[model samples]
Target: MAANYDYEEAPGSYDDVNRQDLGYDPNFVPDSVKSFVVHLYRHIREKNVYEIHQMYENSFQTLSDRLFKDTPWPSVDAVSHYVDNDQVFCLLYREM
Candidate 1:
């Protein structure tokens, strides 16, 4: 089953190291495994939306600093959702 979540742009330009470095598939993951990640991701986005105006605001200095350590931060448009096999993943995409 697919699920939809409301999300805003993440505060910085960081990518998910778990997905990137590990070459893991969001689909086919276990619910218990992904639940914590989803929760943390949402918590960060919620906090950022409550603080930042522009994607550049990067108002959450700690999160912003770590995330955009070496890259330019992008602007996010909306939250995206997907389900593969029995696993589900959601993300915030920056608008080009």
Candidate 2:
């Protein structure tokens, strides 16, 4: 089941990391997951470790079950933009 996300990306530059290094995958990332990731970023930025822990321990798993049950989670390439393609964030996300 393909995700029904319509990404409206504004023009941007991906100079921070090698987009190619993320590897190419054409799968669409669901908008909900992308939004969740961005929200997670805010927690990280604010050093809200407890909230982050609660969100990951509860919300993220629930979200994955709801969103990815029908299809595997997409490749890092499809979702990394939400983290601004930061490799550390990508690695952490992959670990989760």
Candidate 3:
């Protein structure tokens, strides 16, 4: 199912890593995942709604494949809960 997340630019600096530096080691998240997330955030910061939606629609399947290649299927309830929370967060940011 397609997620219904509105694109909204958050207030303040868009550089989340720098602005909210949690002092974690540079290698915490793998480089590949970090790169993907950074790219996604850049589109959001630029308010490129079409591109963001395109990227999510095009890449999520591949991303999920890579992320869960060897893992058991996630529960439907868990997935629904996560997606709902994500939608809420997206709405909150859009309202900012």
Candidate 4:
């Protein structure tokens, strides 16, 4: 027989979600994410694969550390967008 899984709803509305709800430090600074994105863009423009790989690994590690345990990894594009335009991202979440 196959096993069935049940999904649970979040405790609050999506707009209520924040760093704390996501298991991140409430005071976590986004500077690292922003720096990674800036370097990633620079590396891409300069075609520096070695440095790019290093940056990617570092960024992934940071992402893993910031997110809740067991949370699925986000796509690179998603991360990039979040880093580049977090204000817009938060506004969208609030508006939604």
Highest-scoring model, lDDT:
2
Better of 1 and 2 by TM-score: 2
Of 1 and 3, the candidate ahead on TM-score is: 3
- Report the lDDT tens digits of candidate 3 across residue range 15-92: 333324543233233233344444555677678888667656665444435442444323333333333435543453
List candidate 1 stretches off by more than 4 Å: 1-59, 78-96
Put down candidate 2 lDDT per residue, 1-96, tens digits, no spaces. 222222222212231122234543346555656766777777887888886786687667766565454445667787887788988777888787
Residues forming the 10-long window of minimal summed lDDT in candidate 1 = 77-86
Q: Model 4: runs farther than 4 Å from truth? A: 1-18, 21-29, 67-96
Q: Whole-model lDDT for model 1 versus the true structure?
A: 0.34
lDDT of each: 0.34, 0.61, 0.43, 0.45
TM-score of each: 0.23, 0.65, 0.41, 0.41
Estimate the lDDT of model 2: 0.61
Provide the lDDT at 15 for model 2: 15
RMSD of candidate 1 to the true fold?
A: 11.5
Q: Name the runs in model 3 displaced over 4 angstroms.
A: 1-28, 70-96
* Model 1, span 7-84: residue lDDT tens: 223322234453335453333232322332344455454675442333324322333354434543332211233122
TM-score of 4: 0.41
